[model samples]
Target: MKILLVDDDPNILELVNIHLSQAGYEVIKATNGLEALAFLDEELPDLAVVDVMMPKMDGYTLTKRLRAEADIPVLLLTAKGELEDKEKGFLAGSDDYVVKPFEPKELLFRINAILRRYDKAVDTIIEVGPMKINRQSYEVSIGKKVLLPPLKEFELLSLLSSKPNHVFERDFLIERVWGYDYEGDEQTLNVHIKRLRDKLPEEVKIVTVRGVGYKLEVDAP
Candidate 1:
């Protein structure tokens, strides 16, 4: 897998690159937000490590921009351990965050944990009505069989369709499917939901509440 490492500090970049690369990952280096944006044209990374403080643009802005187009996992690094900073990171669309001066092992563990949970979710799928949602394999199916979904797409479907017609507020959906401690901006859920709907059968709808949430409803004969 590939990882885009975004940090203004040369030392941090080199250090993480060495560690992750040695672990057998392809590491793409970026010093700031715009650079990271440029990298997206060539390849999509499996994950990112962004620093809150940077020149030209901060990690928050980078995360917001990238998340607008992709669901790549992000880990924000901040110098201060302030709650406000952590909250700001989430508001800006970070999947997770780590305070600076962190232990290398801890950072590695966090990365592993995020990826592991993602793998677990993708391995299981649910079947209901015309829709098939694989919770683990990230696959969804409809009609007489099941359809395979990749990562976020399957996650969105499985979460909504699991309950079948039960309305789930955006927050509720995000918390359960995206990981209870998930820390990304809520708007990302909208993008994922749109993708899910487009992939589902025409008769099966994941409904949206004008002022509230969403639910998956199967068409009745």
Candidate 2:
């Protein structure tokens, strides 16, 4: 697998490159977000490791662009371990966040977890009541109208619809959708569920299981 590493620190670039290379991954290095964007012009990598602070363009901006353009998964690196910074990273469409001064092994573990989630197989089309979810296209169609949600929201919806009416525990959903090592709290999952609910049609319901978790229920025809 090819990984695009974007950071302003040469040492960081070198250190991460070494570990990723030793792990059998092709490492593509970029000193800044602009340089990273330039590299995307030629070819897209399997995943991206981005630093929050950079010259010319910031990692958050780069992450948004990457999601919009290529739908590539991003793991963000930040010096601040504050919740707000992590929230920004998630809202920017990052797949995971690793604070600065982190161990390389942990980062590698998180990368593997994220890739594993992405690699899971799902049906190409799932029909529940009036909705038809297309996993391959990342779209939900209700009759003639189609809705395109963010990646996280789409994944959440897809998982729920995969086993219609089956209750998925909050923890299991988090681990399956996000990485098992997800740093954020249940609020992140709640937010995505809320967004999915708002986007979906009335025939499709995402019911909160009080204390357990959430499940998808379709109105009886």
Candidate 3:
């Protein structure tokens, strides 16, 4: 696995690089968000560990850009452990947050946990009827065309298509796609579902189970 470590503190960068390298992950070091973004032009990492405060661009902004452009998972490091701070991180599209003065072991644990969740959810490639979902590249294709929905929308579609015709409750879908600590309400899920319905091909239908939840129904090809 590859990790992009972004922080202005040289000592912190060195410390994290040592541990991540020892843990069998290739680490790419960046002193600020701009440098980190530049790195994306060359190679994309599996995940990014970014500091909340940085020169040029803050972690929240960087995280948003990363999600919009590369759909890479992010772990934020902040000095404050306040709920508001954590909320902002999640809203900006971070997968996890860690306060400063944290143990390296704990950081490694959180990184592993996030990766495990992703690995369990994604199956590399999923094909239902005429639609093809590529989890690795985060691409959705139908026939000769390709579409790239937003990160959450792609995840939602992927989960539903993973088990065609199976009903997934709204709460379960939200928890799986948005994380258990997600503060958003069901309306957020509704919006994503609607967006997915708009973007996907007609042969792939997302069926609502009324009071239960939703499922994907693929027409016979």
Candidate 4:
């Protein structure tokens, strides 16, 4: 698997990149959020490891952008150990958050946990009103009728439908489905949501939360 890593500190970038690369993942490195965006198109990684502090563009902004586009797993490296900071990371769009000066082994564990959740992700198909999400196969159906999801479509649908009323910040959706964090562009979320809407039952709705996240609401099936 490939992993996109963005950090301003050359030392941290090189250290983490080397460790992850040695663990058998192809690591793509970027110095800032903008550079990360440029790499997104050229190097599609299975996961992303990002540092919260950076120059030119911060990790939070970068993560937000990536989450908007795809459902990749995101692991955050935070220099601040404050609880609020970690909470903010989750709110912004992170699958897992680790404090800076973290143990490399612990980082590996968090990354693997997200990756290993495949079994959990696919174990069930959730139904809410007209929306049906097949967790095991990553398939989704609308109105109890078969609505075959294209390859990428299922991931997007599952991310939203799994949390009926919970507003999923765009970044969270991106990381959950794309296997990386956001880079700060919410338009990517808009596009996939629009695509998912096409297959959803007319009665079910996926609404935007203004400046926050997205929510999927449904009625009695």
TM-score of each: 0.56, 0.56, 0.57, 0.55
Worst 10 residues of 3 by lDDT: 172-181
Q: On residues 1-221, what C-alpha lDDT tens digit does candidate 2 reach at each position? A: 68999999999999999987765568999999888888888988989999999989999999999898878899998797899999999999999999989998788888878876675643578889989888888888988999988888887888788778888778767866776567999999999998888888888899999988999999887
Cα lDDT for residue 10, candidate 4: 91
The Cα local distance difference test for each model comes to 0.76, 0.87, 0.88, 0.75
lDDT of 1 by residue, 1-221 (tens): 57889998999999989877655457999999999999999989878889889999988888898888667888998897898989999998887889989887567667766765665645365666656555645555566656666666665676566568777667546655565467799788888888777877778887888867888888885
TM-score: model 4 vs. ground truth: 0.55
Q: State the local distance difference test value for candidate 4.
A: 0.75
Q: In model 1, where do residues sit more than 4 Å from their true spots?
A: 121-221
Name the weakest run of 10 consecutive residues (lDDT summed) in model 1: 116-125
Report the C-alpha lDDT of model 4 over 1-221, residue by residue, as the tens digit. 67898888899889998777655457888888888888877777777888888888777777788888756778889789898888888888888898878887678667867875753655486777755677665566655477667755676666666668877766546655554433557676677788888767777888888877788887664
lDDT of 3 by residue, 110-203 (tens): 8877875777565789999889999888999998899988888988988788889988878667666776567878999999999999988888
Which candidate ranks first by lDDT, i.e. highest?
3
Which residue pairs clash in candidate 2?
A: none
Ranking by lDDT: 3, 2, 1, 4
Full candidate order by TM-score, most accurate first: 3, 1, 2, 4
What is model 4's C-alpha RMSD? 15.0
